[model samples]
Target: MAKTFKYIILGGGVSAGYAAREFAKQGVKPGELAIISKEAVAPYERPALSKAYLFPECKFVMLLCLLSILGFFISVEFSIKIKISACLARLLNIFTLMSQLDFAAPARLPGFHVCVGSGGERLLPEWYTEKGIELILSTEIVKVDLAAKSLISAGGETFSYQILIVATGSTVIRLTDFGVEGADAKNIFYLREVDDADKLYEAIKAKKNGKAVVVGGGYIGLELSAVLKLNNIDVTMVYPEPWCMPRLFTAGIAEFYEEYYKNKGVNIIKGTVAVGFTSNSDGEVKEVKLKDGRVLEADIVVVGVGGRPQTALVKGQVEEEKGGIKTDAFFKTNLSDVYAVGDVATFPLKLYGELRRVEHVDHSRKSAEQAVKAIKAAEEGRTVEEYDYLPYFYSRSFDLSWQFYGDNVGDTVLFGDNNPASSKPKFGTYWIKDGKVVGVFLEGGTPEENQAIAKVAKVQPPVADVDQLAKEGLSFASKI
Candidate 1:
C-alpha cells in the first residue's frame, strides 16, 4: 500500500530538522508529517563534523565512555570515577571539553546530536516517536511524479503527499569528477557527512605525524588544514585561486589567513591545483602532482574543491535558475504545493534585489522555517509576509573565526589591524557599492559587534570617503 502524508520533507538535514520543528509548532497532527532521508540516522548539526567531531581526544573519550556504559556492566562507583576523570581532564586542559557529547553508546538510538554547540537538549529517536512523526531513514527516493503529487522510493515504495518540501542538500565534489588521475587512490578523502568525517578521522589517526596535501583553499580546505596541523601532520595547501576563499575574502583578508597558516607551519601553494595523484603498491595515495610541475610526497590527501546542489532529482521537473531550483521570496516554486529550501533553492534575495542560493547553515534553518510557516498560513486561509533574508556566512579555523553579511560585490575597503603577530588582532572588510557599504566582514567580533555589522549591511548606509571608512573600520559600522 502507498503511504500518504499531509506534508513530506525530502532530505534529512538542518533544514529538514527545523522544518519538522516548525510543523509541530503549527499543530501538525500526528502521522500527518514525515521526513524521508537517505541517511540511516536522523538530522544533526552537519558543521560539527569539521569542527568538534574531528578532535582526537574528544573522540577517544566518547569511545571510552560508550564502551564503559554499554559493556562490562560497570558499577556506580566506576561511573562516578569516570565522571571525575573527565572533569579533571577538562580542568587540566587534557582534551576538548566533553560538553557537547553526541552519540554515546548503550542507548545509541538518540545520543549526542542536536542543538549543536548551543547546549540544547539532544533530539533522540524517542523524540520523533513521541511526536508521532514517521522518520523514513535509509531510503532513497528514485522518482518524483509532481503532477501525481507522489514519489517512489528505490525500495519500490510509494509516498503520496499533499505538500512536498525538497531539501536534498548537496553532495561533495570529488577529484574523480574532474578527471584527475588516480583520484580513487586510498587515503584520499572528502568531508561532507558523518561517514566522510569518520573515514578522514580514521586516516588521520592511522597516518600520525604524516604529510598531508590539502587541495582547494576554501572553508573545508582551510579548516581541515588547521585540523591536520593541530594533529601534528605536516600540511601543504594547493588551490587554483590567487588567494583563499576568493568568493567572500578580499586579498587583505586572505593575507592575514595566509600568514596565520604559514605561522602554523602550513605551506600555502596558490595559483595551482592537484593535476594527478600517485599511489603506493597498496593503492594508497603517496604523491600529489601539481599543474605547475611540482611533485610532493603525501601520506594522505584531502580534497575540498567544492560541491554542486543536489537538484538533479528535480531539475527538469521544476523551474531552475542560477544552478538551483528557482523559488520566490516565500520559497514557493512555480508548481503548486511544491517548495524548495536550503542550498537547493535559489530564491530571491530581497535585500540585494537579485536571486541567490545561500549554502550556509543559518540560511538552511531560516529558509526551512519560512517555508513551513508560509505553508501553515496558507492552509489556514491566511498569508504570510515574504522572506527578507540578509546574506550571512561564517567559518571557524583554529582559534580564529569570522562572520560576513550581505553581498561581497563592488570595491572592498580593508581596515583594522590584520597583522598576524599583533596581540588582540582584529580586522574587517567593507564592500562598498555606489558609495554605500553593502557588505561587512568581521573577525573575532563579539556578539553585539556582529549584530552591529549585520545592521549596517541591512541599512547600507552611504560612505562618502573610502579611506575614512577603512580608517574607521568597525567604528563606522557601529555608528551606522
Candidate 2:
C-alpha cells in the first residue's frame, strides 16, 4: 500500500505557512496537507506593527491581493489595526513594502489542500478565498486527541491526520494576574492585537482629549506610549525596571530612549510597578495605583506588560518550560509524529550555544524552513539537520532605527565618529562573547560601519585589526 502521509499543521501564522510551503516543495502533495488556524486569514509577516509603517485599511487590502497572487496553500485570520495617524502612516509604509517586495504574491502553482480557523470574517476570509485555500472561520480548536491522531474544534468538528505540527504563537499576557485590575473596564486596554489598537483609537477619540496611562516598559508599551504622546495624549509609562527595553537593550541604550520619550512630553516613571487600579463610582478606571503607594490620574490605561506562548491546544503532546514548548535541534516535540515551531517552540542554536526561543519574524521564517527540511529528512529515514539560525530583530523609536544582530550575549563595545561638527552622525556597539562576536546593536551609524559591525557581531573578529572599529570604547551615543 502507498504511504498515507497526511499533515495537519495547526495555526495559520508565518511559521505555519512556511512549513506548508516547505512541505510542498519537498514533494508532499496538496491532498496530504491541512492547515487549521484560529483566525480566518492567511499568515503574513507581523514585525511591522510598531514601526510606523502599517496602515489598517491598506494592510487589509494589500494582504488580500497578495494571498491571491501567492500559491494557494493555507488561510489565516489576523484582525488588528492602529487608529492613530502615526500608526496609520506606518501601516501605509508596510503596504508599500509589501508591494515592493512582491511578498503579496506567491511564486508557485497551487494544487494543495489547506484549511483555516473560523474567526476570519470578510476581507480576511477573502484572502484565503482568493488563494483557494480551505478555511473554517469563527471556529477554534478545543483539544488535540493525539491518540486518535486528530483535533476537535469548538464547533464539534474533528480533524485527523498522519502528521501534526503545532505553530501557535505567543499571546499578550494581561496584568490582571498581578492584581492590576480594571483592564476589562471600557477605557482601559491592551494594544497587542489589531482589535486592541482599534479600540484604543476609538477610546482616544471618544474621550475627546483625555489623559492616558501606559503600564509597562517593553516594546509594545514604549511604542504605544510614543504614539499616544505624538497624538498629544498626556501619557505616562510605569515600569519596575529602571530602564526601558531592558530585555532587548542594555542600560545605556535604554537610558537614551527613556529621555527621548520624556523630552517628547511623555512622563516615564521607572523603578516602579503598577499593582492595581483605582476606579471611581462609575466602575471605570480613574487612576493607576502603584506599589510605591503613588497614584497617577488618567482617563485610560493600556497594559502592554508582555506576552507568553499560546500553546494550550497542544499542551500535553509538547513538553514545555515556563509556558514555552521545548524542542530539540530539529524543532521536534517530545511526542512522536508531532513537531513544533515559532514563538511556541524553543530550540537550541549552535550559533550562540544557547537553547532559546525567539519571537522575531526572521527566526520564525528560518525555523519553519528548518523544520520542513527536518520533516523531509525524516521521511527518507535520515538524520535531521539542526535548526540553528541566529536571531536578529530591530525597531524604530522616534528618529532612531535600532538594529540588533545575532544572539545578544556577553560584553559590549561602543563606537562613534569623532567629528563633533559632522552633519551625518554615526554610532554603534558590538556584542563580544567569549572572545568571539555574538551580536551587534547599531543606531545612527554610517551604513558601511553598520554593515561591518553587524558582521563582527555575527563572527566576533578582533576589532584591533580593523581601522573602521578603531574607536571601540567610545562611552555613549546622544541619550534617547
Candidate 3:
C-alpha cells in the first residue's frame, strides 16, 4: 500500500493553525490532518486581552461616576450600576471609561470557538477550520504510546499517525506554586485563556467600586495593570525586579513605563514579592500578603508571573530540556517522524547561534511554516534545510508601541531620541555585531527609522563619515 501520509497535530493554537496552513499550502488535504485541542475555542492573540477586556468591565465604578456626572441633567438620583450580563454591556462600560481617559481603547476583537479556558483569546485558530483543517475540541490527550505509534485521549479514543506535531502552548505558572493557599480558587487567576479574563472581568465587575492588585512586573503584569488602571480601577503592581518588564526592556526603559503607569494612577511596587493571598470569611480574596509582612488591600488579585510549557500528554514520548521539548534546527523532536513547535518546543537557532525556546506568537507562525518544509523534505528523502530566523517581539503600552528585533547579546550600538517627551516622536537604537546587524530597540522613533533599522539588522552596512552626515541632520544611517 502507498504511504497514508497521516499527520496529527496536538493543540489547536496559533502554531497548529499555521502548521496546518503550511501543510495545506503544500497540497496536504483534509483527511490527512487532525488537530486536538482541550479548549472549546480556537487560539487567538492574547497580548491585548489584559488591556482590552479588563478596561471597561473592571472600571464599572468610574463609568458610573461619569454617567452620574453627565446624568445630572437627566436624573438627579437614579441607580446606575454597570453589570456584565453579556459582551455588549461590557463593551459599553469600556467605552464609558475610555471617554474619561486620555488613551483610546483598543478595538474590540472577535472571540474564537476553541478558546474554552478563562482569559483565552478566541480569534487566532479560526483559520484552521477556514483552511479546511480537522479539529477535535473540548478533548484532552491522556498519553502517547509512541512505540505503538498511537495516542490515547481523555475520552478513551486512540489515534494512530504517521506524523505527529505537538504545538502545545505554555500555561501560566500558578501563584499557588509559590505557596499561596486557596490559590486554586476561581477568583485567583493567571491571565492566559479568555476564561481567565472573564473570571477577572466578573470579579472586577462585582467589586465595581474597589481596587485590584497585579502580581509581577513582566509584560503580562504590566499590561494587565495598564488595563485595570484605564478602567479607573485603583491598581498596584508588585514586581520582584527593580524595574518592570525586565526581560524585554532595559532598566531605564522599564523605569520610563513605570513613570508613565504611575502618571496614569497605576501604583508600581518594585522590589517586592507576593507571599500569599488572604481570603475573607466569605472565602473571597480580599488582600494580597507580601513577603515584607505588609498586606496590600485589594478587591481582586491578578497573578501574571508568566507561563511554562503545557506538555503533559506526550511526556515520555519526547525528550525535554528545561521544561521544553527538545528539537533540532528543523523542528524535529527526539522521536522519529514526530515534530513540535510553539512554546513547548525548544529548537536550535543557527542565526543567534544558541538553542532556546521562543514563546512569542511570531515565532510560532514562523516555526510552524518552517516545520512544514522539514516534513516535506523528510518525505522526499532529502535532508531538511536548517531553519534560522531571528526572534522578534513587540508590545504597546499606553501611547508607546515598541518593537524589538533580534536578541541583544552585549553587542549593540544604542542610538535614537531617548528623550521621555510626549510631544516628539520616539526613535530607537540599532544593535550591530561582528559587522552584521543583530538587534534594534525603539522608543518614539519614526516608522522610517524603525523599518530602516530592521533592514539594516538583516544586513549591516559599514559606518560612514559621521561629521559630514551629522551636518545634514538626516536619519540615523546618514549620521552614522
On lDDT, the candidate that comes out on top is: 1
What tens digits encode model 1's per-residue C-alpha lDDT throughout 1-480? Answer: 899999999999888888887887788889999999988888888887777667655466677755645443444335655566554554444233345554433212244465442455566667778888899999999998888999899999999999999999988998898788999999999998787888888899899999999999998999989989877899999999999999889888999999999988999999998999999999999999999999999999999988889987787889999999999988989998999999999998988778999898889989999999999998899999899999888888877989999889899998888998776678999999988989999998999999999999999999888888888889988887
Name the regions of candidate 3 deviating beyond 4 angstroms.
Answer: 1-5, 57-132, 380-385, 411-421, 430-437, 445-447, 460-474, 477-480
Question: Any idea how many clashes model 2 has?
Answer: 30
What is the lDDT of every predicted structure here? 0.86, 0.66, 0.71
Candidate of highest TM-score: 1
Ranking by TM-score: 1, 3, 2
Q: Which window of 10 residues has the lowest lDDT sum in candidate 1?
A: 102-111
Query: What TM-score does model 2 achieve against the real structure?
Result: 0.76
lDDT of 3 by residue, 164-253 (tens): 888889888887776676565446768877777777777776876688888899878877787777656898999888788777677656
CA lDDT of 26 in candidate 3?
A: 82
The per-residue C-alpha lDDT of model 2 at residue 48 equals 39
Rank order (by lDDT, best first): 1, 3, 2
| Tens digit per residue, CA lDDT, model 2, 407-480 | 66677665664232344435556666666556777767555655665565556564433334434442211110
